[model samples]
Target: MFETLSALFFAHVLADYVFQTAKMVQTKDRFGSMALHTITVYLCAVVALGSIAWQIAVLAGLHLAIDALKVLWVKTRDDDGIKPYLADQVAHFITIAAIAAVAPTLWADGIWTKDLAQGGLLDISAWAPKMMLLTAGAIYTTRAGGFAVGKLMTPFAAGAPTESLPKGGMMIGILERGLIFLMFLAGQPAGIGFLIAAKSVLRFDAASKNEKAEYVIIGTLASFSWAIAIAIFTLAINNGLNDAPLLEIMAAKD
Candidate 1:
């Protein structure tokens, strides 16, 4: 069940974050754009689930239904704020979990079983699950996490710098969260202190206004907290994939 959930969750994140483009998001109400996005979801499932099966169809079809409903709700309410965004994501996650609960054995006779299951570097089947979880972690910590933080920080945006470089803040958040994710993966949480200190020094501005400083502090804390939580969850899932208890894995790492 965990395996299935991890794979489907990864596919969903990949489809929604990485494969999905800004134009696709903007035009999601259109059938062509929605269908293209659903296709991407289907293909991502094919890769993550390691098979072409009916389960994948169910996953994609339900995803399309959820997205269609979200679009309809947004149009009816004439609002595309964070409420609908978070709700839509929650719906998709519930759908993924449902499918995972009943998903069949995807790796038993999957695409990777024939040519690559022998072992070693070519044994994709052996590593694909962990890879999926790790990739999902990376995407969530950067792209998805950025989107979430941006939405949550909307109210506080009034005090943010108006003269900043184009997408500079977004880029900085991505890099910061990515570095945090890697640090957790490497079991070096201590390094995050240095990262925070370095950023503080670099962004030490006129020291006259505190609004921008407060906003920056809030955003950084949110980003770091989200990255850390996701990183721990990813590592826990990876440990489970390896058939090891979380405590045992941590102990071994130590």
Candidate 2:
């Protein structure tokens, strides 16, 4: 069940973030484009959940409604902000959770309790269960985390004239956090420093001035801090869930 849910969630991350192009994203409000996108979502769900036609239909239906609502919401917005992004994810998660809980075979064993623990390291929570945690972190640190950082910088940004970024800062923040999170998972702290250095160099021309420099520092730190915190928590949770059992330890000796 845990593995199944992880597959489903990862499918979502793949479809929504990794596979969906910027062009697709920009045009989702129109019926034809959205229909194409919805088919992709359905295909993802089916691939993850298997050949169950009804289950695929349900997931696809909910995903479409949720995404359509989001497109309309964004279309009406003055400029993009965090709440809608978070809310959209929240609604999708709820739908996923419901399906995970109510679906036939999946519903019965969805929980990741000790009963599912077996098969030495292969069956360990670290290998199977933690995949979900990592995938979820990847998904959240994208637009969702970007939105959070935006909110954090609101006070600093208030009344200040907006500086239009040639490359959208939203996407940049997503990549930054996602990379940092992966670095933490890989146990490579130095990569994060390198990332910061690279980013600073990129922005130095604009941020060399006093006011811009201060804002850049604050935003950069805040983004780094959020990513680092999530990485730490993810590692910690994976460790806890994957703690070695006496049985597994004994088996290791054999």
Which candidate should be chosen as best, given lDDT against the real structure? 1
TM-score of each: 0.85, 0.62
Q: Estimate candidate 2's RMSD in Å.
A: 7.7
Q: Which stretches of candidate 2 lie over 4 Å from their true place?
A: 104-136, 139-179, 186-208, 229-254
Candidate 2 least-lDDT 10 residues: 245-254
| Regions of model 1 farther than 4 Å from truth | 116-123, 206-208, 246-254
Q: What TM-score should be assigned to candidate 1?
A: 0.85
Listed per model in order, the count of residue pairs whose N, CA or C atoms clash below 3 Å is 0, 0
Model 1 residue 251 lDDT score = 17
lDDT of 1 by residue, 1-254 (tens): 66776788799998999889999999999999999999999999887766788888988999999899989989999867667777888899888878876764665446654464443123466666767778888998898889878987887778786646899889999999999899888878888999999988877782236768788888789889888877887777667667777533241132
* Candidate 1 displacement at residue 249 in angstroms: 8.1
User: lDDT of all predictions, in order shown?
Assistant: 0.80, 0.66
Pairs of residues clashing in candidate 2: none
Q: lDDT of candidate 2 vs native?
A: 0.66
| Residues 1-254, model 2: lDDT tens digits | 44445556766777787678878877887788788887888777665544445776788789999988887787887444666666787898778767765663442232322243531122233354455557766775665567678866776774332458664666678889989887776767679889988998988875787767777888888888878876665565445445533122111110
